[model samples]
Target chain A: MQRMADYISVDDGLVDCEVYSAAVYERELESVFGRSWLFLGHEGQLVRRGDYVTTWMGETPVIVLRSMDDVVRAYLNTCATRQVTLLPYDAGHAEVIVCPAHRLGHDTTGSPVSGQAVEPGHECLVPVARVETYGKLIFGCLSDDSPTLRESLGDATWYLDNYLLRENIGGLQLVPGVQRYTMPGNWKLLAENFAGDDYHVAITHASVLAVRAQGIEPRLNNSPGKGVGANLSVATGFQTGVPHGFLEVRIGEEFFEHDLMRAQSIGPEAAEWVRTRRDAVDQNLPDLAVKPYSFHVANLFPTLSIIGNGTSMEAVGLLVWHPRGPHQTSVTQLCLVDAGAPPALQRQMVWALTHQQSAAGVFAPDDHENFERLAENTRTFEARRVPFNYEMGLSGEGVDVRPPEWQDPRWPGLVLPRFTEMIQRDFYRYWRSLMDR
Target chain B: MVDMELTAAATAFLNEEAALLDDHLLDGWLGLLCNDVRYVMPSTAIMPAEAADARERRNALRWGSFGDDDRDMHFWLYDEDYSSLNMRVRRLDTGMAHAELPESMTNHVVSNVIAGQDPLDSELIRVRSKFMVHVVRHENNENTFVGSRWDKLRRTDDGLRLAWRYIELAHPVLPRTISIFF
Candidate 1:
């Protein structure tokens, strides 16, 4: 295996395909996933004491739980000594975590208790190095040396604030469960797609957009039709403009009124709450203002992404691109709503999530087909030789000139014009930096 | 109580529906539904079995087993009403639903069909059946989905029309894309 120095061959804006290779996948399991802050679960999943959910921190399975004191903690789902996986299912609230392997049991804090022939102070379940949160989104890191979640997130938090920490809808609550599915694809392909691949929307997902043009917006009707468009032209981020990009879907003033009516039909209070919060954010954060009907989609570093319908900030659509193997990815989705929102509205959010995102969603199939084919084609010897071009808006007439305002010290990271590959390029650069370390 | 004749008729209708799906006759299948028809498949989640409360919560989110309450809280794979189903069919008609580029060859195997009078509405009949869909895409990639369906059939002038259906998949993680109806 080549060291980090020769791992990538940058030819202009093209980078070597070794980043998606099987061997490098293993190294990433070590260098990237192992030492990076990974999204574990949302805090709302653990409202009650003993509420826990099993997730992957890299390839290693870990159980994150809220303790009796309400402090969240994470521990490897395997028995410390036997290494036998303790939990088999996704999530739940349990009084004690008992390993069926040896009858070993541990409290929420990973302290060993009564178990078959287990001695005290001999260790219980192995604890994950760190557990942290940002806007009710819980994250875990396996390596102690990893940066703090806030530090790692950096400018990405700015985008999260627009959706997650909006004034009235500050705390987003993940609904009770998750929707998970797998695809025959490399994980990075999906990650890059979420990061900033606006160019593929018109071509790769043309059919999805074509279906949306049929006119039955699912957000308004609670149906299976497309609700959002993919005309992603302008966006903002802390680095580039906030860490948020807008999908260029123009719903005229009449449609916006119709959308408001539909939102009221779902839940008047929730609709009013979202409207007030959205207006406040738009008014307060002038730089972060986006078009009313434009979808807000942003990827937070490694894999956690939030995509929403431009209508309201009520539903928080979360997707985690989990690396199962070199050739397979497990995509998990969670749609969250405010805890205080009406149950009917929460259900509507969940319903809207199904219509728009998720593995079984209308939009997902479009992106999945691309990622699956991209993964398959890249594995070929011929495809590996050709570098993937990300040279758009790099220079000349189409260069993404950085606006003068983003140069202010208030905005973090390198800023560039919207619709450029800068965000994705920055993604890889951060990835390369992590892998190199 | 439903007589064997009613059961036989329901079984035949299901069989014909399966054949229409296999033949990719979406319009024909759509024609069998009433205006208020709801075709839904609930999203499946894996809950820790060791925790009974968790399991109960998860199951509560899921569609109750056949004959239980029809109301469900879990997100759906396809919670399509008539208009949505119509839109979906129209999408396929456009021949632009790229996921079906080389249109998949599918076989819908339906079994364990039981028919009875609806407890709440005598005019509607309740039919419970299990289905296994064998989908072959690109002549190589094959996927099998096993699930149970509860259908509320209402007698219409045209014949017994499907009023509502709840398809609950037994698997937690589904095959890549469910681009076609079950």
Candidate 2:
């Protein structure tokens, strides 16, 4: 196995293909994902007592549940003795966790309540390191030494809360089952793509935009910004704030107005709600300076991504790039709606997400196919010899731009223009630090 | 009574549609749909055998607790009206759709075609067929989609046109994507 040092160079933007190597992947399973605060599931998934949902912490099976005592807890889903998976379903409610094999039963708190030939105080399921929440989002850490979720999120919280926490609404709640599918790609590729990889959209998603344009002729006139080029020119002056590497691209007033038209189609009440929220944001958070074609493909470190739509108000739900192997990733897509959003708005949000981001959706298909090809190409001997270019909009040494005055004091991180490659650079450096540690 | 002649005609129509899709004749396939056709493929979900009841599944979907959306304005794999289908067909036909940049080689094998008069509309015939769509791309990547389709065909003065179609994918987790239609 190669040392972690061979994986990347922060100076020249040289990232070794070892990042997708099985050896490096093994090390990451221990050093990276093992210690990081990983997104588990939202609190809405386990609202009622005895509610539980099954998920993964890297390759380890985990169960996140709302206990009979009304507290949220997570535990390794394997039975202690034979290591059999305790939870058979992805999600369900049960008074007691039971292992189908050998008939070992555990209480909601993961304590061994019933089992034959067992020692005293022996639990069938091992509890995870920590279970914490930021608003309704639940996250778990496998190692106790990992920083708290808020601390781990750091300055990115400001941008996260902007769409997560609404004034009139409480927080975003995940809508039903998460859309999941596997694709041939490294998990990190997904992380990099989502976290400020806007450059690929115009090319990778050209067909989708073209298709959408054909759907309605007026859409051509209703471009998100003056155009991509104009938006980048304006964003360059905005400057990068800190090295948090989080990005938020906001749309112009016309985008919201277009959404307002869609909301009006839903109903009058929904239209009023959209109008009120739009006006409130415009008046209250004037410093944000909502621009045309603004959207955020914000990544929270290792795996979780929060995608904010340019046209809509709330952030698109969580997108988890769960690594099954070096070349395999299982994607989990969740849709979140504002708690206070009317049913009509909720429906609209869900439909919008389904059409745009879901597995069968137009946009996601474009990305996944490309990622699959990337994984194939990168693994080849010829491609690994040369480093991929991340030099766009960066100085000779790859530092992002400074933050604008309006966002200076409030937002933190290596604030850069929306179109810069600095955000992805910061992500890789952060990843290297974690792996090295 | 099961009319053999009508059944033969319905089977021929279904085969013709499949051939159109395989030949990348999207416009030809689209032409078979009536003006107000509704093509829907509900998002598939993996639920425990106990939660397999239609009512229970619908309830979970309604509450946004389990599965994908119920056939409301909720999440769906494909919930297209006529105009939407037009857009989809138009997009696929365009050379720019990167997903189908070089269209995947497809062979749509259809069988078990059962046709009968529609109970709701006398002019409409209900047809059910099982299909297995084998799609190969780049000579290396390939997938087989096994599903059943329920289509409503209305007898027009010229010919029969598909008024409604509901495709049910058997697998809870699709192999990769349902990028191409079922």
Best by TM-score: 2
Q: Considering chain A alone, what is the TM-score of candidate 1? A: 0.84
Ten residues in sequence with the least summed lDDT for candidate 1 chain B:
B61-70
- For the record, the alpha-carbon RMSD of candidate 2 to the native fold, in angstroms, is 4.2
What's the residue-level lDDT of A6 in candidate 1? 62
User: For candidate 2, lDDT tens digit of each residue in A49-83?
Assistant: 99888889898889999999999999999988789
How do the residues A212-268 of candidate 1 rate in per-residue lDDT, one tens digit apiece?
676765553421234432233333333322133333323234435545666676677
lDDT of 2: 0.70
- What value does the lDDT take at residue A3 in candidate 1? 64
Where does model 1 sit among the CAPRI classes? acceptable
What TM-score do all the candidates reach, one by one?
Answer: 0.87, 0.89
lDDT of 2 at A278: 62
lDDT of 2 by residue, B82-176 (tens): 77677667766667777786788899999988888876679888887899999887758888988888788889986989888887787665677
